[model samples]
Target chain A: MENNLCIAGFGGQGVMTFGKLLATAVCDNTDYNVTFFPSYGAEQRGGTANCYLIISDREIGTPMSDILDDLVVLNQPSYDKFVSKLKMGGRLFVNSSIVKPTSDRSDIQIISVPATDIVVGMGNIKVLNIFMLGVYIGYTEIVPSESIWKSIMEKMAGKPSLVELNKNAFEQGIELGRSQK
Target chain B: MAKVLMKGCEAIAEAAVRAGCRFFAGYPITPQNEIPEYFSKRMPEVGGAFVQGESEVASVNMVYGAAAGGTRAMTSSSSPGISLKSEGISYAAAARIPMVYVNVCRGGPGVGVIQPAQTDYLQATKASGNGGFRMRVFAPATVQEAVNMTYKAFDYADMDRNPVLILSDGVVGTMMEPVELPPMKSDDEIERIKESKKKISCIGHPLGERVWIKPGVWDTIMWENINKDAEKLYESWADQAEWESFMTDDAEVIVTGYGIAGRIARSAVEIARGQGLKVGLIRPKTVYPFPYKAYEMIDYSKVKAILDVEMSIPALFLEDVKAAVKERCPISTYLRSGGNLVSREEMVSRIKKLASR
Candidate 1:
C-alpha cells in the first residue's frame, strides 16, 4: 500500500520539515519505504512552499503522485490550490485558525484543527507543524505516537527546551483531535 | 544498522565522506548546492579540506590539484557551471588526475531552469572537454543507486587514474529516500591511499617534472604523450560498461533510457506488460561507455522496434541508441525539455503506439 501526501503552507510554516520528519520516522522506525520530494525554486520566496511524500509497504518507484491521499494545508491559498487534487475519500487536515477552506467537497474527510489557536496558547507559532502532525497521527495512526515523539526530539536535538514546548503542543493537538473523533 | 532517509544531495556528500573523499571544492548551483553545503560542514569533521571556490573553474582546478596530490577530491555543479569547468576538466584528463565530479544536470543550452533535465547527455558522455577525452559516467535511477554509484566512483577514478562523472538530474539530486549508507573509511586508510601517491604526486616534486608543459615553450611531443595515455585509459574503460536489462528476453519492443528517465520507463514497461503489451527496458547505468554490447545482445529477430526516451529535445542520447541498434528496428523517441519530466504514461503510450506500427 502506498500513501501519497502533499503538505503545503506559506514559507516558514514548516511544511517541508513536517514531511521530512514523517519520511524520516517511517524510514528509521518502521519497515516501510519512504520518499520525500520537495518543490523548490520560485515558490519558496516567501510564498507557498510544499513537498510530496510517499510511504509504502513495497519499494517506492516514484517520489510524487498526481493525486495525493492526504492533503495538509496551513493557509487558504494552499487549500484552494490542493483541495481539488485530493483523492476522493482522502483525508484533508486544515489549520482552521488561519485557513478557512471553502471547498464544497463532501466526498473526502475534512478535519479542521485550530492549530494556530492551540499554538497561541503555547505562545509559539513554530510548533504549529508539530501540533498538525499530532492531529494527523490522531486520525490516521500511520505510525505510533512515541515514534513521532522520538522523531521530533531527534530533529530538535540541539534545542532541548523547544522540544518540551513541541511535545506539549503535540499532546494538546492529540487530545483535541481525540475529542473530535 | 538502521536505514536513513536522506535527500540525494546530502546522501552523495555523506557517501563521499564514507568513500574517503578528503578534499572537496565546488561552487553553489541549484539542485546541487547541498553537496557543497554538506561538504563544508562534513569535510572538516573528518579532517578533510573543503573549499567553496569562487567559480566552477576555480573549483574544478582546486579538485584537480587535490587529486594530483593523491586525495579523493570531488566537485559538483549544474549544467552551466559544468560548462564553465570544461577547461579544467580537460586539464585533469591530460594530467591523468583521478577525481570525481557530479553534474546534477538541469535544463540548458544555457542556464535554462533549476528543475531536472538530462540535456547534458552529449556534453557529458560525448565531449565533456576538448582533446577528445572520455570518463566513465554512471547515471543512477534511484537514491540508493545514487549512493552506491557515488561511493564507488572514487575507486573507479583511482583505479583508472581518470575522472568519473555521476550524471544525476534535479530529480535524483533533490529527492529524498531511504538508503543504507556505506561504512566510513578511517583516517588511516585515507593516509595510506595518499601515501601511495608520493612517488608521482606533484605536491613535493620539482616544478619541471610535475608541470604538464613548459610555461612559454610549445611541446608537441608532451601533448602527444598525454593524449596517447588518455586514449589508452579511455579504451580500457570498455570493460567497465554497465547496463540493466528489464524483461528484454522475450519482448518484441524494447524501450531504452538512462538515469531517472530510465527508471520511469521501467515502471511504464511493467504497467504495459500487465496490459499484455510485450514492452521491455534497457537502461544504461554507465552512459559514457554507452553499453553498446548490451544493445547488440538484443535478439533482433523478435524485436519490432526501439524507443528512446529522455528529458531532452533533439534527443542527444538517441544517437548512441541508433548506433547500437544499427537500424535493425524502427527507432522512435519520446522527449521533453526545459525542465519538464519524461512522464511514464507518455512513455507507455508511445511504446504502445510504436508496437502497433
Candidate 2:
C-alpha cells in the first residue's frame, strides 16, 4: 500500500514541519519506505510553502506525485491551489479557523478543524500544526499515536513548557477527531 | 549504524566527513545550500576547516589548495555556481590534485530556475573546462546511493590523483530519506590517508627536497606527454564503469537514464512489468565512463527499441546512449526539460507504447 500526502500553507504555518514530523515518525518506527520532499525556492519567502510526503510498503518511486491521497491545507490559497490534485475519495484536512473553503468536487472528503483557535485556547498558538497532525493521525490511524507523540517530544526536547502545551494540544485534538468518527 | 532520516545534501556532507574529508570550501546557492551549511557545522567537530569562500571561483580554488597539501578536500555548488568553478576544477585536473566536488544541478544554460535538472551532462562529461580533461563522475539515484557515492568519491580521487565529481540534481539535494550512514574514519585513519600523499604533497619539504607541482607545463612536448598520460588514465576508468540492469535479460524494449531520472525510470519499468510489458532498465551509476559495455551487452536479437529518458532539452545523455547502442536498434527519447521531472506515469505509458510497437 502507498500513501501520498501534500501539506501546504503560507511560509510560517509549519507545512514542512508537519510533513517532516509524520515522515520521521513513520520512518523511525516502521520498516516502511518513506520520502519527504519540499517545494523550495521563491515559494518559501512569504509565499505558499508546501511539501510532499510518501509512505509505502514497498520502495517509493518519484517523491513528487501529481495525484495525492490526502492534502492538508492551512490556508485558503493552498486549498484553492491543491484541491484539484486530490484523488477521488481522497481526504482534505483544512484549518477552518483561517480558511473557509468550499469545493465543487464531491468525490473527496473534507474535514475541517479550527486548529488555530483550538491551539489559542490551549494557550499556545504555535501548536496549531501539531493539533492538525493529531487530527489527521486520529482520523486516519495511519500510524500509532505514541509514535507521533514521541517524535514531538524529540523535536521539542529542550523546551519543557512547549512540549507540555504541544502534548495537550495533540491529545485534545486527537479526542476531537475520534469523537467525530 | 542505524538508519536515520536525513536530507540528501546533509547526508552527502556527513558521508564526506566520515570519508575523512578534512577541508571543505564552498559558496551558497539555492537547492544545495545545505551542503555548505552542514559542512560549516560538521567540519569543526571533526577538527577540519570549512571556508565559505567569497565566490564559487574562490571556493573551488581553496579546495584545490587544500587537496594539493594532501588534505582530503571538497566543494559543492549548483549549476551556475559550478560553471564558475570550472576553471578551478580544470586546473586541479591538470595538476593531478585529488579532490571531490559536487554539482547539485539546477535547471540552466545560465541561471535558469532553481529547480532540479539533468542539464549538466555534457558539461560534466565532455567540457568541464578548457583542458579537455576528464574526471570520474558518479550520479547516484537515491539518498543512500548519494551517501555511498560521496564516501567512495574521495577514494576514487585519491586513487587516480584526479578530481572527482558527484553530479546530483535539486530533487536529490533537497529531498529527505532514511539513510544508513557509513562509519566515520577515525582520526588516525584520516592522518594516515594524508600521510600517504606526503611524498607528492606540497606541504613544505626540506630545502632541495621539494617537488614543485604546478597546474601548467610550458614545454610543448612535456604537455603532450601529460595529455597522453591523462588519456591513459581516462581509458583505465572503463573498468570502473558501473550500471544497474533490471529485467533486461529478455526485455523487448530497454529504458535508460541517470541520477534521479534513472531512479524514476526504474520505477516506471516495474510499473510496466506489473501490466505485463516486456520492458527493462539500464541505470548508469557512473555517468563519466558512460557504461558502454552494459549497452553493448544488451541482447539485440530480442530488444526492439531503446528508450532514452532524461531531463535535458535536447537529451545530452542521449549521445552516450546512442554510442552504446551502436545502430543495433532504433532509439527513441522521452524528455522533460527546464526543471520539470519525468513522471513514472508518463514513462510507463511510453514504455507500453514502445513495447506494443
Candidate 3:
C-alpha cells in the first residue's frame, strides 16, 4: 500500500537512482511486490530519465505507471512536465529551490521544500537526492523510517564516511518538513 | 508459469531453450535477429549450443546438421533470409529431419522494410521449397503465443520429422511485454523423448571405432534408407490445428488475418462492433493446417463480405481466405506494406465505408 511513485528530472539529477532506492527499500522493508523501471526517450546519453515504481500487496502486471500516486519533480522543466498529469489526491513533492509556487489545486497535496538548499546548507550538494528521499518517507510513512535509512546505508556501504553525512542530511530534511507541518 | 513482457523473437528463443532444444544456428536479420542474439547469450547459460553461421544459407544448413545430429535445432530470419534458407529447409524436409524455423515477417516479395508485415504467408505456408514439400506452420498473434509455439514447433517437428515454422510479425517482435517463463524440463524427461529418425545418436562407438560412410553412399542406398525410416517415424504436427473465434455467430462480416495483422484486426472488430457494425474477427493461428473448417460452418448469408486485413499487398493469405470462404462469402482486402502497420481506426472506417456496398 505504499504507492505508484514516479521521479522525473534532468539527465544527472539521480532521478532514476532515487526511484531505485525507494523501490528497494519498500520491497525489503514492507510486505509488497515491487517493480522499478527506468525509461528514457530515444537519446541514450545526456537526455531526461524517468523511473516507474509500483509497490503493492498485489502483483504488478505492467511495470509502468500511467497515473502516479506520488511524484518527485526535481527541476522547473520536470515540474512543468508532470504537474498536470499527477492524479487527484496524489502528492507532488516539489524541490522549491528551483520551481515557483503555481495555482492551488483542491484535490492534490503539495509539499514545498527547498530539498537541495537544505542539503547544501548541510555542506554537501550531492546529498540533495537523499534529502528529498527523506521528505517522502516523512510525509507518507508508507515504510519504516529506520528501514529506509538502513537501505541507504546498505546502498552506500561501499563509501563508509559518506553514510553518516547522508543520514544527518536525511534526518534534517525530515525534521524540516515536520516543522512546517 | 505466468505471462511476462518480452520481445517476440526472444520469447521464441527462450521457449525453444525451455523445450530442451540444445542447438541453434542463425544469421541475423532485423525484426527476427534478436532470436539468434537471445540464444547466443542464453543458450550458453543453459549449457546448450549456439553458433552464428556465415550467412542465412549457412545457418539453415547448420540447423540441418544439428538436427541430423539428433538435437532439437532452430533458426530465425526475415523474408529475404528465409529465401536463402529455402534450399536447406527443402533438404531438411526431403531428408525428413525434424527442426523449427522462425520467420519474423516483414514487407515485400524482396528486400522490404524492417517493420512487421504478414506478406510472407504464401512462402511460409504453401511451399517455399522444391518437390512440393509441405511444412506445418504456426502463426502466433502475441509474444506468449510465439513462445509457446516455439516449444510446440519442436515437438511437432520431431513428431512429423518435418519443419514447423512459427511465423510472427514485426510488432510482436519489437514490443516488450510481461511474460512468465515455464520451468526447465528435467534432463531425464528430455532424454525420455523418443528420438525420431535420429541418424546422429550412435551409441557404443568412441574415437575411430565408427565406420565413415562416403558422401556418395549417403545419396545412394543410405539416403533412401534414412528417408524410408523417416517415413515410418511418428509425425508430431498432424493433430494440432486451431483458430481463435470471437463473436462470429451473428457476424455479418468476417475479418481475417494472422499474427500482427490479426491482432490489429481484432481491435478493429471491437471498434466496428461498438459502432453497430456486425463484424467479427477470424484470426488464423496456423497458416499451413489453416482452419478451413472453422469458416465452413459460418452463417454465410449473414456474412455478406469478409475483409482480409494484411501488412502486405493483396496476395497469398488474402488468396487463401478467398478460396476458403469463396462460394458463400464475398472477400475484401485492406493492405499496407514495406513494414507499415495499418491502424485499427482505418480498418473499422474502411469496413463501414464498404458495408453499404
lDDT string, candidate 2, B51-139, tens digits:
99999999999999999999999999998999999999999999999999999999989999999999999999998888899999999
Model 2 agreement with the true structure over A1-181: per-residue lDDT tens digits: 8899999988887888889999999989988899999998776456899999999998787888878999999988999999999999999998999998777898988888888888888887778888889998988888999998999899988898777788888898788777766
TM-score of chain B of each: 0.95, 0.99, 0.89
What are the per-residue Cα lDDT tens digits for candidate 1 across A1-181?
8798999999999998889888888887899988898988656456998898989886665666666899999998899999998999999999999998798999998898888888988999988988998888878888887898889889889988787899898888777767666
What is the DockQ ranking, best to worst? 2, 1, 3
TM-score winner, 1 or 2: 2
Best by TM-score: 2
Stretches off by above 4 angstroms in model 3 are: A1-181, B194-240
Give me the displacement of residue B213 in model 1, in angstroms: 7.7
lDDT (C-alpha) at residue B225 in model 1: 74
Report the C-alpha lDDT of model 3 over B1-357, residue by residue, as the tens digit: 444445567778888988989889999887777888899999889778999999999989988877776778888898899999998998888767778988888877778776667888888887777656678888887666787788778877877768888888776775444456766766665666624333334323567766331222445777677656544542333345678887799988788888877876876787688899888888888877777877886888787788888888765688778777866767878887866677666788888876666
True contacts kept of each: 0.64, 0.68, 0.00
Total clashes in model 2, counting residue pairs 3 or more apart in sequence or in different chains: 0
Query: Candidate 1 residues B216-282, lDDT tens each?
Result: 1267886677677678888887877899998998888999999988988887898789889998899
Task: Quote the positional error of residue A94 for candidate 1 in Å.
Answer: 2.4
Which regions of candidate 2 deviate over 4 angstroms? none
Q: Residue A175 error for model 3, in Å?
A: 19
Label model 2 with its docking quality class: medium
TM-score of each: 0.93, 0.98, 0.67
Compared with the true structure, all predictions reach lDDT values of 0.87, 0.91, 0.75
